[model samples]
Target: MVKHIWDSDRAAKLPKGVEELVYRSNLIGSDRTVCNWGGGNTSMKTTEKDFRGREIEVMWVKGSGSDLATMKTHNFTGLKLDDIRPLIKRDQMPDEEMVDYLSHCMIDSKHPRPSIETLLHAFLPYKHVDHTHPDAIISICCADNGKQIAEDIYGNRFVWVPYVRPGFTLSKMIAEGVANNPHAELVLMEKHGLVTWGETSETCYQKTISIIQEAEQYVNDRINQHEVFGGKRYQPLPEDKRKQILAGIMPVIRGAVSEEKKMILSYDDHDDVLEFVNSVQAPALSQIGAACPDHLVHTKRVPLYIDWNPETQDVHKLADLIKSGVETFTSEYQAYFTRNQQDGDQIFESAPRVILIPGIGMVNTGKSYAMSKVSGALYRRAIAVMKGATALGQFVSLHENESYHVEYWPLELYKLTLAPPEAEFSRKVALITGGAGGIG
Candidate 1:
């Protein structure tokens, strides 16, 4: 369980502690086990002076793709609450148009757009609000008996919310849930995560910590009682040890997973990565949708898992097996897109971003090294929650259609088109003599 790191002595000197909120946001967002990179959002409701020196209500929400660990006040956009509040009553809006409207609501259009969850934070009647996708909360939220489990642990303190598609739909559901139980301490979104609020930043942050601690303990107790043999953290092989596993096998898998662009591989064998690769259910659970809806944009709906054990598998024949596996994964992904894609859905690259090896651990691939790392990190985060959820009950991930919708979300898909193309290096050569012959 993670503890709240707040310093009152220092907070007294800062202006409104917006800086303190930024500090807390980084603490929560940076913890991979708590919330993967950019997987969650946080906000604070406060008064700010506009250009005319007029006092105006403003809510600052984390910007898209901003890593909370390093986020500054500039990374959060302050939207005029007066403009945002009106959105609560507007019955329906397209996701893309809604994002446009949110951008328009910004007090400073120059600032990055506020999160889609901006409205959810604005709807709540609190001074400080923090939202996260902690694995401990996930264990309870995604359990087979999620509601009852939450009620058993939280009683009347939390209001259990059923899963609804995120964005305005979720914001609306939250609005209703809040109105129904004004005194509720927390809100548990089934198949999602937890939400908590308070008058002060410390209260809200501490409450979040306490909730997760209880849930973590609950899962651990259940595992011990049933003798379920909770998962272990696998030791990563050293660089020398990894040479045989990845050296000769990478080109084969990378080349096979391509059409026009070659794939770059990111390898890891950390505890989280190993937990998934070594799990009894890696093949079954890794194929289920993303850990959270927010992860779809980064990790895709599923990771491609290949069954190769470096310790005993035949090294010479590894290339053949990998080629077949990549082909199978590609065909299956294309079929998934064809069957599930809507009329206006744009086609995406069919290659897998993440891959799992039996003894070698996991490898995530991308067009670039950084993207491959992000892909691997997210899948590893997803698997952590799945492992924790198993201890409580049968782990449940998002449904197939739900996963498809999020991965192809119109507003989200539009953002993909906006990314700058990767920089290219052109060929330039100079004739040079061998070391023995070259002279100035």
Candidate 2:
């Protein structure tokens, strides 16, 4: 279960409002169990002076593409609440128009872009609001019987919202749900995450933690009763053997997947990774789709799983198998893109960001070390979500069409443009022999 780390003494040191909101966001985001990196957002509404020196209500929200764990005051965008709240009455707002309208509401043009869910935070009548994609909450949200499970767990304290892509419509639906159920304390967006609010930042943060704890306890109680991944079908090889095998086959796998662009590879053989990859269910589970929509941007819609018998197959045979797997994955990915392509959509590389190898572990591919490491970490979280959901009931992943839309969403892709252009050595590895002398 996620720990309750809120410190009253420490919180007392910070001034209330956005300062308190940042403290709460950092506390929740520090725990990966509470939310994936860059996957959740927090906000607070406060009265602040405008350019005209008049006090005006403003909503300070986490900036787009910012990680909650490391954000500061400057990382949040403050928008005039009066300008934003009126939009709740609109029957519908196109995502593009909504984004444009939001820009117009910013208190300062220099603040970063407001999060995609800024409207949700503004529409809800609360001083403090938090929306997080906790693993435990998502496990219940991603199960086939998720709605029923939610009803059993929280009764009427939380409102269940059917799956809706994040934007104006979802924000409206959630507002209406809460308006109808005035006493609801939390909002659960199906196949999405949790939203909690309170009159104070501390109240909102504690409520978020308490709700996730309940969900975690519920999953933990039932997980052991069910066979894990239908009982692991294979055991990991010895550490020395696993590393030797990877050393020989890593280059081969890398070469095959880097046809479009060079990629750095990150390998993980953690116990949990081995447990999943060696299971009878890994291939099928990995192919279904991402457990959460947030994972699609980093890990892709699905990973490429290489079926290899570690005990019976040598490194050469494993290399051959990776080659075949890459060929098949590339073709299937291309087909997925062809089927889902829209007028303005540009196809991403057909290669998979993640690859699963039985008796070995998982390998993530990216343009840099940090990127590859993040992919591996997020995929590990997906593994955890899969385990918990399957234990509770049938695990339900995002549909292929929905997955494609998120993976190629224009707004999401825009985040990449914010980074500086790559340098000459952006993806190259260099060994500097004089590093100790500072010259390197």
Candidate 3:
């Protein structure tokens, strides 16, 4: 894994905080291995005078969907430090309410929502903070004995934090750990990622790169040339046949998942998809849950798997299989919802947003084309993460119970409600019998 640190010669001209942070952010963000798109968050805590001219400590944290690699000053949300302290001390706060608390603290009324991890960055007693779900680090973090491995490797150099859903409680847990071991420079959140902070932004960024490098070394030394990788990398439907294949099958999936409006479908036919589908362990490992915590919203839990062989299966036969797979997926989703839903919540659409067809490629559906693409990207990353995890050991992720909690989290559901309701398709359907071949 390559680590890109700030380079004075290459730095772009901008305000100090924004320039330095953005420079540092892109250095890592540019490398998907360290932080893929918006998967990580960064911050700097500094004192800025309020409108009354009295200086107040405030945190500038990465905002929602802000790609660190391409971030600007406006991409961060600035919140008063004092406002965050009260939140940290609270024993509990619902995730959605926590979002409200963060929004309430934003110094600028127009700032987009801060990251869900805003509190986490604010509560830590450090001038600068950086968190990333580096694939190498995550490979180790997700191990069954991940914490033990972390401890054996870093000892007192880093504080090993067990997996906790990222929220106010997680921030509190991290704060307590830091207090107990004041000298620690890094904290590893098992099955999540790494958090490093320092008195300077450069320090935090550098430390993050260094620690992840160490993790890379550890994994390389252990899994070196294990011949653990074995699979025939298959190509998706020939490029020429791709359009025909999708046209034949996507309608069935869209109709199955759509309640009142159309659901957009995304198909993947990249070489990597073929490799994962044809892999020896495809059956055992692809069933795991979303690649990362935030991915739960974009990709949902596990994807529906449709077993097919392009060499032998005809297009018509494959369409029927895809339809059957979606039906089973929706039914399973219904059962899952029935078993886990709280009294007030209702069941969601039966559509399997993420689909894996062995002979084709990965598929995803969303309310819109953009969202479908986002899910597609996340699923591709999921494939990479899963491949890495299985090579090391059996792949396991947040339990089905955890997936349920996140999938149904009020905040995530709230996002869906923000989109305009699907247009009424009922108005478009017609009997059409009398005008045409007619049996009115």
TM-score to true structure, per model: 0.89, 0.97, 0.85
lDDT of 3 by residue, 1-440 (tens): 65646665565464656557767777777877787655789988888988899999888888776777788888888898898887766789988788877778988978768877887888788888998888777776667667667776788877777778878888888888888895687888866778888787667777888888887777766655554336553445676686777777777767766753457777777776777776666766667666677677777787887777777888888878877887788788888888888878776666777887766677788777777887887777777666556556655688887888878877556545645666655213335556664454
Taking the tens digit of each residue's C-alpha lDDT, what string does model 2 give over 1-440?
Answer: 79888999999999876788889999989998888978899999999999989999999999998888988888999999999988988999998999999999999999999998999999999999999999889999989998888888999888889998899999999999999996699999998899999888889988999999999989988887888888887889999998998889888988998888888889999998999999989989888889888889889889999889887888898999999998899999899999999998887777889999999999999889888998998998899888899988889988999998888988788767766787898767688688788576
Model 1 gets an lDDT of 0.75
How much is the lDDT of residue 398 in candidate 1? 81
Q: Which regions of candidate 3 are displaced past 4 Å?
A: 10-12, 96-104, 220-224, 227-260, 413-440
Rank order (by lDDT, best first):
2, 1, 3
All models: lDDT?
0.75, 0.90, 0.75
Instruction: Give me the candidate number with maximum lDDT.
Output: 2
Clashes of 1: 0
Error of 1 at 429 (Å): 17
| Backbone collisions counted per model | 0, 0, 0
Off by over 4 Å in 1: 224-242, 309-312, 414-420, 426-440
RMSD of 2: 1.6
